[model samples]
Target: MLISFAMRRILLPVLITTGLAALLMAAACSTAPQPLEKKSEPTFDEGEYGGEPLPGTEQVTIVEPSPGGDRFALIRRRTPGEPSDPRFQLWIVDRDGSNPRLISVNTHDVAWHPSGDRAVVTVAIGIDFYVYTIDLETMETTQWTGKESQRLSFPVVSMAGWFRDGHRLLVFANQKAYQQPFPRGLYVIDTRDSMTTGPLVKLFSTTCLGNQDRYTVGKKYVRSDDPSSGNFARYDFDDESWRWITDFPKDSLRFVQKPVPSPTSDLIIQARETGNAKQLFLMNHRGKDVRQITEFGGDIPVWSSDGSYVTFRRDVHRGEGARYVPFKFNLKTRKAEPLWPVSPDSVPDFPDLSTQTLDKLKPRR
Candidate 1:
């Protein structure tokens, strides 16, 4: 009787094992690997800028003034054909909507020269920084890529503009090769000679982000004993001198938009940060005309031809929602009014120069 009981127990366990094996085999056969459903890549079309046209503006760019009167230059990124990977193509409206002409297809960043006859741009593939000159007359593009590597460098050889002479171009080539440090300095490139100046000039060499001192082992973005502040400096090639604009305070918020130097090189109109707000300020040739124009603290101020009005986009952050509000400011009345269909995804269109700065609007010092 004991032997029979043991045999029964063994048979029961064997039967359970056989059932489980059969169930597993059936599941494996039923679930043969299926081919992956190819995911269609997101496509960005040519006219697909994510914003409505500003009211009274037909997707046209706003024109600010330069050295000459009524010189219009607009830049828009368009992937005209069926896109594999998107690249930015520049278009210029030199005659103000007469006919938009294609400038270059491989351009990454483009800015008109003070003369408004040419442009300075950076063209990069993956890690290379190639500074190129776009000739407006011939629509011919010339690139300068030999001096630097194309690594994912920080301070990214961005911020190009015509110097005081309009004969030379200034480029900020980021040599750090990473995002950890601020840009090393400004590099002055002669357009005619194609000669570059230096690897350092003390302009934006400090931390752009406000946290710099807490350099611990696991800490990110904190440099050891970094000043936790930023300072603006200008290199005078003529005098071989360096000047300080200001040392950004720790508790104070500050940002320097493009430094728009005057025709006479005596003043600069800057988009700056005050506390949590961004506003427009004009600095005289002596760098002292720090007067507040409009108080729409969140938007950037782009000057108009006569410095009479400025156009900008404001970001309104409300809890989980955000809205991009386009605005135009009249300087004489000190009033800012909203423009067009409001959307959180809308952004600023590339601005161009329509009229030139006549005279410094006597600084309100």
Candidate 2:
């Protein structure tokens, strides 16, 4: 308190210099490089699995061969733009890849009738979560859902598939999509009714239906990730009960997809992630008997009507871009071939499937 003028001046500069040095040191440390921290996956996607959507080409094309295997119902992007449009235009192409006819726009999913002439389509554009049946022969569209467009009957609803009776269509409703408790799962809607409103019965409760869910058989349904982890389970219509097919280990069940039931109704064929390769496997309806069918990469596994073969989609890169082209795999012969070729019609319609499609695939010997 009684310091001299020279002593005070010298001490003040020293204090100021020290404060500046400390601040510089902290700044240098803040800018120094640190190890990168891996971002953690959310619990929903971390331990729990199943219901992984097919990447890339899922936004471009989805080809569903008619039950008769003589025609293909294709939901293809009208144009591969910069952002990649979510809306798809449904087209019908012959088994030989001829006669490509544009069916509908804003088509989310299409489940064909057993006769292959008709399809139940889901239009999920904007407020239009409407499901309808389209007649290919007449090019006529009839709205099945959303008769009372003023309100939503269910928060989450999509056409699963047409039942064997043809008059009934299976619809999947899950409130879990809105982060709400699931009060609905699978139900039946009679196209026999003009408005498709009443008499809709709730079959059971399944919360994990990924976006653009695909359902084929009512007796067999796939699950999305839930509390423990997502495992493929079969729903028994006979017993009106849920049966867990938890034979496989939890990790192996990750990314299991397209559990298409075999024509015999015993074995289920699906594609799953194996190491780095996406391969095919056959499992029992109860989720046992997991046998590896192919070591090559395949996705969207579709079993033939007779169950002798599987048609799948695999990524193919042209000089222009990457495409998920269709390919056929013979189970008995253990051979893989291109399912269909891109038609080079002067017009996009009236396409053709050629053997050269395999050139892009380069099937393994």
Candidate 3:
């Protein structure tokens, strides 16, 4: 029995050691499968409703917010399923309680010009571009016809301030500026000479090396994709130079919206993150200061006229999963509060609007 016990101990140790060695060899020989490559596609943005109006104050969509002045545009889809065309009508509302007025009776993809003198609008049916100029004093509408091309999905003109001469208009179309799918270049057009009857001339194309397609217009500068840091850049179309404007982290940079250039052109605001952890960055082109005005978790950040405030949509995290909540961020206080009283269940989409024309949208039905 003593001999048997001694033999058993010796055999067990040898067997365990042998088994472990074999397992190690097998693991070393096996190869791990590589992870699948990811698809890079822009996610749809969430929607942010405006603040509560005064007692008996009509509900309006806040378009842009500044220190004391805010511009809001109300848009209503033509009665859904109604006999009338299934298009969105436009209206403009002043921050001060003023009745909304019509801008485009039938138009989508509205783009404002750099001079703030007119808006480039594309109607349903025809792909031609039409300019809608509003008289600030009398509120009269003047329509100008622009050059025809396969119009961009979301086209924007350089703001009045961004141009060196204050007269040139830069239009960016989603028609392959550098590569296919995304906008690759910008077409400069001189609208000051247009009489709405003759053929419009095409200006030189603005090009960027990397997917630097998405951008917003400013005075003598176009704030676009830095692509290097996944942040924003202010491009000088005339001098053919680029300057980095914002310093959003790479992770947050992925979620920033296709920046909305303000009327002044120097300032821009965009969504810089996604889901229930979204944030908005107010950036200045001349200075390197980036302020995080809103920490609301959502997407889409649009700046106001005065560049003091911004409106954006955020998400509300519910532990395991998350829900989207709209919000507004004040730049001065750095307060990011929920804008919506009741959250929206449906996924939101914040379409691009021309600041000049946005003031003219009707409410959605």
Candidate 4:
């Protein structure tokens, strides 16, 4: 009897201690931090052209998305089998790849109006290019620039963007005067009245930040100034003057290009070269708080209309000649994701082509 009581007392304490240890371990594990579940990358199928497989000789490039993010503009080029002029086609489609329609043929460049109801397209004939406005609702096109003889003579003309009011178009052209050297400058044309074109600046190699009142123009060539340096300025439409924003330095190593302002006009995104690779950077409008955004290397970083996202072309293969894949970066999440499929074979197949026929397409005037 004495031995049995002694054994029971020892066994009870041991069982109690063992149970407490397991309970403590379970509590710790339940309260501990858990690893985050990895998210699968979003997949987008290759887009079709008029519900048909994209030809091998055709290349499609996404230009810009509308302000409302409902529609986007793209450029399609068809390379000829023989050595002849390649065909350029401009297309506009919804974000979901619906309502794919041809806007114009032989279009050089295009920019969407802020209202997303129209687009400004540049058409080239021979050596001359003219700007025209297309009403998306009516599909009626109007030549914003006057007749060929009265229009400014420039070997190249590009549509920049619309002013804050969306009534005027900002353009960049090369002005070739009689018996004088050609000069490239930025000019603004009133859409309501195309006859009124006002010169904004007299600088070469200039580019405007779409949806913003700012532009980056090449600096005056001085003996001491670096030949690659450029100037960023903001245009005041009220007074028709430019206010200097900052200077983008050019050196033996890096060349700055495409300084685009965010939709809110508080941030700017630009590309800079380090060694042989180009990377994207984000900075304030005043040229402060500069920080690198990408490390793999990207170019042509264009902000979304709402400033919520940025789309850029990422160099996937360095050995290849400028081979690129498109990606989107979310500002809120600070994450980069693939925007579209990299390979042409991965493009999604269309279910029905009955409604999407090229016969209904109209030619550009």
Candidate 5:
């Protein structure tokens, strides 16, 4: 289940529909054939980013932007027409939806630094997943983890959240390779040392869940979204356990699910069931002043780097088929426009641009 969650995370974010329609659409999307664009080399400049601010929130930072929050999750067969496991071919675009670039192929998971230039990416070799850091400017990939033995190694590593310091990672991994390799749980890894030889400390021993599992990785709590509803809980790293969420404004959120706190941590975007349809909404942290954002579909809504915009998926049905589209909604204007180079008419559609800053979603403590 957790491994499937990791695959879901690579697909980025999307809200599950209710009932049979939801299951059917999910099945359709899962089986839908995606077009494979010609791959491109990295085109980032060295001077594109610098200087970082502290991200907000306790488990996540609502203030600092998450660069990893912007990658579109996708499945691209490295060896076309061959039966194999699903591999991600990630596409990245600017917040305005311009400058679409194929970041990497055959990747597993990704976690970006607050700087929006560097990424901690995971990839599967044969049986185990390896961690690597990508410097967009220099276009270099560095191995972050290695193994000496099967029992003393992390067979699975998914970068879940980052600390405010930006050098520590809240990662999901399993120490040993087993016939059943569901991740052991969450652990802290410091990148201060060379990543390939970093330290690891266990945090919990439950079914380790991350953003890939459709849970919003927060500072004090991990908000897991149920297609039917949502739950807020606190993840106590110090105690190595989790507790129920406290001080939340859940006064009128009886029908909310897939709730994503913005990078600022002041507002949350959620899906509310209404008129037999699920639509997107934006409300305050207190859960007051609720307002509708999407009239129809708001699949996997995520905040942009600066938190001024909300990126969402729009499913367009034409004739007998439907295509999922990516759109950026302006908070100030209260209007949503399609991200550039992608539209309802575009073939094979596009991937999500922003998946939420796991670091930024940490509640302020």
Candidate 6:
């Protein structure tokens, strides 16, 4: 089942508006504006927001760690203010909380290449969203998709993950409003084959594992809108088939999301709701040896490079809104702890690269 979280819904609309404004301004100007004599790197004032800050919280969702585990990519958001326009920013930082650099501005989702030399980012350009590959070494970006990915209305494109061979990407696209004839589903794009363009080849209608090309996981829905009758199933890419894995009681309302496999093992972690709230569960590749790993509620679980631990966000309800706190769980010890110590005064410093900096580090074509 595709669970639309509150954060995604809140950020997409705001960023799409900003993208549309940019497009309008570009179209209105007949002549290109003169280049600025001095273009400094973009920077944010530390003390710009001087008053009592808004009650809402800031969060960092870990996308993926580098193959070496020395660096990781994440999306950071600070809501309840105008400066928060463009909703989210993609950041890359060291494991020790050092050398934090802002790679993409106003991007919601990111997927790292297995080689750790580049990352694919999803950003709104106007009424449509597209994916671009950013070179981590030179900080140069290349738009990977074009007219083929566009929809009649709001088209949302998400970078699921890279294929095991790192030659193709698993992408998911759907119109904000469904169109009967238009197709909406998961697809795999050949990263190396530039001649092959347009909406990628649709593989299935639900989510799947990134690196494992052989098997894809999604819900088997009996009805169009109802999920209570659904059961988890795995799709075989080789044979082009799906096999049911789990079937809960029909009377119970169960929802599943983010069924990710461990980096080094056959273990898989997923979130499901069989009770009041969604909780994390651990199971083998075949969906056996099912075990509950979290009780206080968590979602979007990502495994470390070593696959020894999993990190997820825990939602805490405040007065009007909610705050997502990050936590890490150890598989061996079966213990959970706060990912980072709480600091009321701490503010993250996001790195900004100047045009000159990017030009100096531009990758060779």
* Candidate achieving the largest lDDT: 6
Give the TM-scores of the predictions, in the order they appear.
0.53, 0.63, 0.47, 0.66, 0.52, 0.66
List, residue by residue over 108-194, the lDDT tens digit for candidate 6.
677678788988877765556666788888787766544443331234556666766777766665443354333445566676764
| Candidate 2 lDDT, 49-97, residue by residue in tens | 2222233333334567787888877776544332443246676777876
> For model 1, how does the per-residue alpha-carbon lDDT over 1-365 read when each residue is reduced to its tens digit?
01234332321111233333232233223333233234542222322212433333322223333336454443333332324523454555432334445555445555567667887766555565566676677656665533333221342565455554666655664445544344445556676766666644533432111111110000111232453444454444455555665443433222345444332223344565443334555454234535544443434444543344455655443222233455655443445665333422333333232221112111010
Backbone steric clashes in candidate 4, count: 1
Clashing pairs in 4: 46-347
lDDT of 4 by residue, 1-365 (tens): 01234332321111233333332233223333232235542222222101222223234444577888877676655332323533566777666545567666677777778888988887776566667788877877866543544344443556766766888777766544344233456666776656446455665334445334544332332222244445555554456556555543333213455567765446667776543455676655555556555656666677777666787766554442434455676665556666655434211122223333332222232
Q: In model 5, which range of ten residues has the least summed lDDT?
A: 53-62
lDDT of 6 at 303: 75
Question: Is candidate 3 or 6 superior in lDDT?
Answer: 6
Computed on alpha carbons, the lDDT of every model, listed in order, comes to 0.42, 0.51, 0.38, 0.54, 0.43, 0.56
Give me the overall lDDT of model 2.
0.51
lDDT of 3 by residue, 1-365 (tens): 01234332321111233332232223222333222233452333333322222232122222333223443443433432343533455555454424445565555434333344444443433333333445544556543322233232232222111233434444443222343233434444444764121011122122111112224332122224433233345555445555555444443433345455544335455544433244454444343344444433435555544434455554344233334443555444445565434323321232333323434422211
Q: What is the TM-score ranking, best to worst?
A: 6, 4, 2, 1, 5, 3
lDDT of 5 by residue, 31-138 (tens): 432322334422222222111211210010111125555443332323223235233554454443345555565565555666677766656656666666676666
Runs in model 1 lying further than 4 Å from the true structure: 1-67, 77-89, 94-98, 105-108, 124-128, 146-156, 164-166, 178-183, 199-229, 250-259, 273-277, 285-289, 297-365
Show where candidate 4 strays beyond 4 Å. 1-62, 77-87, 146-156, 175-184, 204-206, 209-230, 238-254, 341-365
Write down the lDDT that model 4 would get: 0.54
Runs in model 5 deviating more than 4 A are: 1-87, 94-99, 124-130, 145-152, 174-183, 194-231, 236-258, 271-278, 283-292, 318-320, 341-365
Q: What stretches of model 3 exceed 4 Å from their correct place?
A: 1-62, 65-71, 74-85, 96-98, 105-168, 176-184, 195-232, 243-255, 261-267, 275-278, 283-292, 313-328, 336-365
On TM-score, the stronger of 2 and 5 is 2
lDDT of 3: 0.38
